[model samples]
Target chain A: MSTTLGRISHGAGLILVLCFTLFPFYWMVSSSFKDQADILASPPVWFFTPTLANYADIFADEKVFGAIVNSLIVATLTTALSVLLGAPAAYALARFEFRGKSDLWFWFISNRMISPIVLALPVYLLAVQLRMLDTYLVLVLIYLTFNLPIVVWICTDQFRSIPSEIEQAARLDGADQFTIFRKIYVPLGLPGIAVSAIFSFIFSWNELLYALVLTRRSVQTAPVMATSFMSGYELPWGKIMATGTLIVLPVTIFALLVSRHMVRGLTMGATK
Target chain B: MRKGGEFVERTETRLNPGYGRWTPFWFLAPAVFALLAIGIYPMLSALVTSFRRYNITRPREGFPFIGFENYANVLSDQTFWQSLGLTARFFVTVLPFQLLFGICIALLLHRPGLGMLRSLARVSLVVPLATTYAVVGLIGRLIFNRDFGVANQFLNAIGIGGMDWLGSPTGAFIAIAVMDIWQWTPFCALIFLAGLSMVPVEIEEAARLETSSKVALLRHVQLPYLLPGLTAMLILRSADILKLFDMVFVMTRGGPGAATDLVSIYIQRVGFRVFDMGTASAQAILLLIMTIILSRLYIRLIYKEIE
Candidate 1:
């Protein structure tokens, strides 16, 4: 009887946990398909004829589409650049005996923890002064502050897990440091690099403050554009929900694809 | 002596002349350069600006070097202190629940059976973890809508009156905190789950032999074992909460008369809304100091406990 009671409680707990975590997502997506009236319906319209008008409207809007493209471009570039720059640095940190190596690693990791607000004005001013405002290049470069640290930290941990004996053997052969890094570390560290890439991509994609402040019209990303829907006196619930869904879709997919590594991704090199 | 000498000689001759002292530097160069440009340089510029009268509006004045004036002005500002307090309140209020819920859920899922349901619960819980903060804020607004929100509907069903979740100051704060907890508790759970996986089965079984009860086992054994994960979760969540901008911005925009005005929101206002660059920079520096101090304190505390 006690065992049966335990099983029932466990099942109930699992369902409750799932609903609490996933209901917001369900609400967002479900409400997106509802008309403004249906969306506002009290006791919440659990059953309704779903419509694609919200998606249709968003797709038709030039500004929204432009923001989507901008977000895609920025997220892609940031991920690519962060990996290119961070992997070698990570390898060096993992394998080499260098002065201030721990300090360097700490510095890198600490950079990830900084509030974006601290960097916002300075970066904004610098971007404005350089005529780089509303440019993809500037945003991509600035995103390196957060992304590079994560990449280096994760990849360092990744490379550390791979026994250094392989690299040493390659060194003993005629392979140079660069060759060994490219041939051995890159392949071995591919999974970590993928995790870093997904994280950088999602971060760049989800970023709002920088996207809002740094760009005005030409370079607005999806999150900033999503906020624009909220600025009017009357909230565009349908449109905002649609935009929110669109913004969340890619990140959700990327996160799930790398869900196995999320514990490592989030905790950095601290845990497994 | 011979073995030591031979080892030293072998190490000295291990790498060809090509891969020398500068090899690591060369490897680290790009990331270093990126960090220097993107992180260090901007930080220094912000630090320098904090000490000067660098108003973005009054560029013609050439940012006269007014030592300690900006800092003094920001320190005297009541809103600065209020925002700081609110930020702390948000962090303190929401973090414990997240940690608790996280540990609870992790413990639940860590149970021996209910295999498929356990995996399903694990994956579904991460949905919120994957959702963007701004998006979460938007979702919160919808669900907490006074007239037609799902929350009010649920309250009505339970024979309670509906409250204005985003209108009243206390209500708004609670709403945002609940939203934050909802989104982040799963993150805590994931980390704690990872930590639980690292806990030795032998240690657990030995501890269980004495207690023979789940609650006692958790309190005596599992909780102690989860300290590292707790620390990491605390440090990670605290830093983000202290700097929370996007969520609060989207949800309330520090609304109901700045009741939810965190320092990040205040600093943004001072910089962008008020066009007071110097004061904003000073505020940012102060915030940076607080974060570094808090994080260092937590790290020291966690490590001291471990030792």
Candidate 2:
């Protein structure tokens, strides 16, 4: 009887926690479909005739597509470059013994620990000097500063986990170091690469501060575009919510789908 | 000495893939070069700029080296201290709550006989983690509005009454704190859960047999594993709080007053709003030092070296 009571309370607590966790998300998505009047309704409308007008309003502004295309371009290239450059370095760190290896590893990871403010002024100046402001190449290069660390750290851990015997056999088969890395490790470390790619894409896609300062109209990202709609007295609440939901959709799907990997990604591979 | 050295060399050749000394360099060069050109070079440039009078708005003044004047100005600025204090206050406000709630939720999910509820709750937890931080700011704006917000309606339902969450200084601070907790508590929970999952079933059962006290079991059996994760959580969270900008920038814009003005926001104001890059760079370097010191100390004191 006592055990039954405890179980009941446990279930109740779980439900309460679930409600808190999902409530704001529900509110955001529902409000996206709301009209102007319904969005600002004081008591808050629980039930309403949902509409596509807000989404239509968002796309009606032609810059929205350009912003998304820019985000796509930046995120894709960032992911590619991170994996391409990171995998070989990760293999070195994982497989070899070297001087200052730990120092090298820490230096890579500590890059993320530096405040964006510290880099923002300098990066802006460098861009102006290079004449590379508001370009896809600039954003991709900037995105790599932090993303490369993530790729190295996670893929290092991943590469470490794959047995050394596999490499031994590949080497015995007369495969060189590069051949072994490509044939043996790349296929085996796909999950880690995918997770890192997802992380790089998500961060690059969602990042706003650098994107805001660096890009103007040409290479403006989705998050920047979302914030751009946020100015003035009569705020476009419905459209803002709609654009937010759209911006948030892919990440939410990725988060829910690969939650285990997402946790590892989030904690910078510290947890897993 | 000769025997020890020879023995070490034998094992090194066996385990080290017998590659040339420069092989690692070949693999590492591109990444190192990229980091230098993009990351370190710019940071060095910023470091040099911090000592000079380089305001973007005032080009006529020229780039004159002003020695420690910029640093002195940052040290003397009252708003800079106030912003630093607020940043500390913000970190303190949300951390304990996130830790407590996270551990409790993890413990709850770890409890047996709720497999169905467990899976569903796990998925829900990642939603906030995945949501764009700026969108979270937008969400904070809608939900914490003075008159037309669900926060007020819920308060009324609970008989606590509604206050203007974003209007008053204390209210705005609390508003940002709550949003931060909402977003990051899940992260803490996820980490603790990862720790808890490592606990052996036999050990947990053995502990349970000794006493019906969950606290005792947590203190004795589960805590050892959780400590490593906790240290990691602390390091990341401290760095994150110091650099926090996008969410608060969108949500509060450092607020109705200076209530939500974190150091990051303050520097942005200095650098972007005023175009005073020199002082801003100085401020950034100081914060960067603090971040490095805090994280390095955490790693040295407690964080288990990742193998």
Candidate 3:
């Protein structure tokens, strides 16, 4: 009887917590489908006739497609650059010895904590001087600073987890440093690279500050475009939700697909 | 053949003397260069700008070096103090609730016999994490709209009078805080889940054997183990929150009489809107100092824990 009661209480608690946690996400998706009138109706429209009109409006009128392309380009480039640069740096930090190595590692990691707001002003002036405002290159370069540190930090752990013997054996077999990295370390660290790529992509895609400050019109990413929906005198709830849902979908799906890996990546030096 | 092989080995050894020390530097070069250009250089410029009497309006005309004037003005500025106070209030109010709710949800999900539910719970919680702040602000605006918002609708249905969510100072603060909690609790939960997984099964089982009380088990066993992860999460989240701008920018634009204004919003307004580059740089410097101090404290705490 005691065991039964314990199980019942645990089950009840789990259900309640799960419901509370999930209801907001459900509402976001549900409300996105509702028309403007239905959305404002009393008693909160939990059930309603769904429509793609909001999505259509976002695509056709809001120029959200352009923003999507901009986000993809920036995120993809940032991820590629972070992985290419950060992976080997992580390998070197993990496997090799050098002077000022710990200092270098800490300095690299501390870059993550530097608030972007402090950098925004000078970057703006610099961007203006360089005539690089509202350009993809500018956004990618700014994001690389943020993404590369995270990649190095995460990939360092991943690289450390791999045994040194494997790389040594490859080296003994006449494999050059580049070949060993390509054949041994890269293959072994593929998952870590994937996690880093996903993280960098998400960080760049979701980034708002640089995108807002640098881009004016032509190169605005989705987050900036989404902010514009709320800018003018009147708020456009329908289009905002529609664009938001679509913008969130790609990262949400990727996050869900590799959540386990993400967790490992996140907690990478935590346990040790 | 042996001699030739030995020669080849010697050449290889000379060429690569054990995991080439320059490899990491070569790999780290581009990232370091980018960080210098985009990160360190800009920061140094801000530090320099903060010391000068630079105004954005007078871009062509150079300003004289006014050592400490910007900082002095910032120190005397009442709005900066208010913004800092409001930011402290916001952090203090929200961090605890987020941590509690996060741990609770993580614990709930850690139980057995919830196979499919577990997966669903994870994904659903991550949706909010993946959602952009701009979207969160927009959604929050809709839900918290004064007249026709669903929040007011629910209040009216429950016989509570409608409150102006973003119209008043207190309301605006609450609304922003609520939005933050909704978005960030999942992040805390994710970290807690990662930490919880590291808890030893034997300790938990032993606690369960001794006392079937959930609270007791958590208090004596789990909480101690969770301390380091919690501290790390707190530091990361606090740092991120101190720099928060996007959601508040979208929600109220630091409006309803600057009551809900944070340090970041104030800096943006002063710098970009008013074009008081000198004042703004000073304010940015102050914020940077505060963040560095707080993060140093956090690092010390984490290091103590590790020791």
Docking tier of model 2: it is: medium
Global lDDT scores for all candidate models: 0.87, 0.87, 0.80
Candidate 3 or 1, higher TM-score = 1
Stretches of candidate 3 off by over 4 Å are A1-5, A261-268, B1-21, B298-307
Model 1: per-residue Cα lDDT over A1-272, one tens digit each: 99999999999998888888889999999999999889878768789999999999999999999999999999999999999999999999987776898778777877767899999989988998999999998889888888998899889889989976787788777799899989998998899889999999988998988887899899899988887787767777988899899999989999888888777776665566
- Weakest 10 consecutive residues of candidate 1 chain B by summed lDDT: B298-307
Q: Write the per-residue lDDT of candidate 3 for residues B1-307, one digit (tens) a residue.
A: 9999999888656545665656767766776777777778888888888998888799787867899999999999999999988888899989998999999888877877657766677767767777777777877888788876777877888899989999998999999998899888877787787677777998888888999788998888888878887877777777777788988998899989997798888888898888888889998888888777765665566544431
Indicate the worst ten consecutive residues by lDDT in candidate 2 chain B.
B298-307
lDDT of 2 by residue, A1-272 (tens): 99999999999989987987887888899999999999888877789999999989878878887887888889999989998998899999999988999889878877878787888889998899989999988889988998999899889989999999888887777788888889989999989888888888888888888998899988999999888777898887888898889899988887676788776776666777
iRMS, all models: 2.2, 1.5, 2.8
The window of 10 residues in a row where model 1 chain A has the poorest summed lDDT is A263-272
Order the candidates by TM-score, highest first.
Answer: 2, 1, 3
Task: List candidate 2 stretches off by more than 4 Å.
Answer: B1-8, B16-18, B301-307
Q: Can you list each candidate's DockQ?
A: 0.67, 0.73, 0.50
lDDT of 3 by residue, A11-89 (tens): 7876776676655556667777888887767656777799888887877964789999989999999899889888888
| Model 2, CA-based lDDT | 0.87
Better-scoring candidate (TM-score), 1 or 2 = 2
